[model samples]
Target: MKYDALQRLLVEHLNSRPVPPHAAARLARVRAAALARHAQRQRQRVRLPEALGRWLTAHNAAARRSAWAMAMVTALSVGYLGWAEWRTPSEADVDIALLTSDLPVEAYLHPNFTRDL
Candidate 1:
């Protein structure tokens, strides 16, 4: 090839849009190895939070089960409270109690009933 053609080929290759396959492969390997080494070093220098995170993930199922159990207990407690409120004695219950007792209904129903007691 002519010297001018060789110079043009060198310039074009240098300004190429895509990388050569071998260079790309080598760069990928270097980057991957660097990242792997960083991760390994980070693991060796483990912090409390990282260790705790690992522990939590390892017991993920147990954590989920405990959370579900707590939720069920809370739901049951709320439901029981609602049921108790609904079952509370009303004015009718007082009237029924009065009727069942030996005392006269009118005396118990009188305005002075509380004051008399």
Candidate 2:
């Protein structure tokens, strides 16, 4: 493959090149910065609410897209909560409805119940 030949030439050139004295310090700084960024992102995730953080981490979010992703997560969570609130009856509602009445659950399961109604 063309990529295999290119990689071989690049490897030979790198092996034959002399290492610069300043390269170590530069590499160390770059490594430290990368590690610090990684740690900071971890801290940010920890500080976030657990569900949002889990969703983002599960998807392997990119560092540069985190801000937009966070906004999307929050909006989606809010919309979901709002929708769920409107779509389903709360426990209190069921309790209130049955507070003064009792019905046998088996009544609803009888095959002729609907036909008789």
Candidate 2 segments exceeding 4 Å error: 46-117
Query: For model 2, what is the alpha-carbon lDDT of residue 88?
Result: 96
lDDT of 1 by residue, 13-80 (tens): 98887888999999999999999999999779779998889888888797889989999999999999
Tens digits of per-residue lDDT for model 2 on 3-103?
99999999999989787869978999999999999999877745457777778677754763887888999999999999998999988886675564465
Model 1: clashing residue pairs? none
TM-score of each: 0.36, 0.38
Instruction: Find the candidate with the highest TM-score and give its number.
Output: 2
Q: Show pairs that collide, candidate 2.
A: none
